[model samples]
Target: MAVKPNQTTILLILRIFQSLFAVLVLALSSFVAHWYNTTTVVSSPSQINFLIFIAIFSILSVTSLVILPRVFSNRAVANPYILLGIEIKNVLFWFAGWVALAVFLSRLLFCRGSVCHAAQADVAFAAMAWICWAGSAGIAAVGVFKGVKKSSGNNVEVPSGGVKPEAVEKEAV
Candidate 1:
């Protein structure tokens, strides 16, 4: 199947949204964690570390999903191998980003008794980021699924004689 320009445009838009959400998640989570840790007398080293890890992961995933596509798609030559590699990368980043968001959500929910006391702004930002990231990841996954299916659908098999057995039977009858 021929790839339409609209499909590419849609994918780019979704990726841009995903990258924006990822940036929000990183910044808000970091700021909240830092603020909570500094204010509270009881320090939680693990929580801070986890936030840092999430931020780093989001940065990497966003970079992969946002930057690599433009690089791969803009090549002078239409290399099938390069396209396939990019599809694989998209799948990985989308899945990873989704999982990271889930982890962040879980951490927020499971904190004990103001252990990770985030500011009102931080909480709001994190919630918004979660919603946006979920949408972005879902779109990316759909793109990956359709891409793989389309590639497979293109490789239809034909009979050796290029004629159906049903045709031969009908002729005989």
Candidate 2:
């Protein structure tokens, strides 16, 4: 199926924002974790580490999805089902990562200093990143559903008389 130019442009814009938000989350979370490890006796919270992991994973996966199709121009790389699957996976992971980070931040009795502020910013960016991913997944889901509908519509059956629908319509005319 041919992709419309506008749809391609919109998806590209959404992906760019997703990448930017992921990078921002990564930077903030890393700063917070490093600050905790170097200045304080306690280790950084597990949520921060998970956020880092999600950011890294998103960056790598999104990069590959964007570049691989252009580089190889392979039909498999451009398959809508595969694209939908990856988008859905990212959506779920991003959702979990941000929620976990928010919960961890809420449990803190006092959040002060630059590190605390950075952690708060990380939560905000993580949530934004999740939104971007969800948008991508929604677009992919629509494309997949449309493709399924089109394929099914093409397979309409005739009656036992073997009269084509088009032929019946022409006879009526």
Candidate 3:
């Protein structure tokens, strides 16, 4: 029988995919930016620069979130709320970056070169990265909600000026 992977394993896989997509976006956007800088009178578009920034930020964020915990087993890197917040922000940044790049590409009247193709690939990879971030955010949100519910349900009510039953029992013994 094959062993089924748990939620943590699935989340780790998703993070790996997110990292790969971010790397691809970084490389492709860097290529297009360099091409424009060297070959064209106009500088690289602002959208490309934005994508580059997003890619670098995503790579660093994922590295810190996923890898740091393993390397430093004793230290707690971040709480669940912080992780969810970062995932949400990444989703928004990636969405804006890819949409801006797509718009810039669409505005070009005549795009028929390697640089143009590279830009198109960059947009695709950015979109994929956005999807991954969104997925991660959704998962994180669910986990946070579940944790809240579990903690709340475990609360034990005590009467006024009275200790918990377990505490009273321990004192009596």
Identify the candidate with maximal TM-score: 3
RMSD of each: 12.6, 9.8, 8.7
lDDT of 1 by residue, 69-130 (tens): 44554343323344345445544544454455445646665554443444333344445545
Per-candidate TM equals: 0.46, 0.78, 0.79
Best by lDDT: 3
Residues 49-123 of candidate 2 have per-residue lDDT tens digits of 999999999998789768765555445775657767888888898889889988988998999999888988998
Regions of model 2 farther than 4 Å from truth: 1-5, 148-173
lDDT, residue 22, candidate 3: 93
lDDT against true structure, model 3: 0.81
> How well is each residue in 36-146 modelled by candidate 3, as lDDT tens digits?
899889998999999999999999889877865455423455456676778888999999999999998899998888888999999998999999899878877887665
User: Candidate 3 has which clashing residue pairs, if any?
Assistant: none
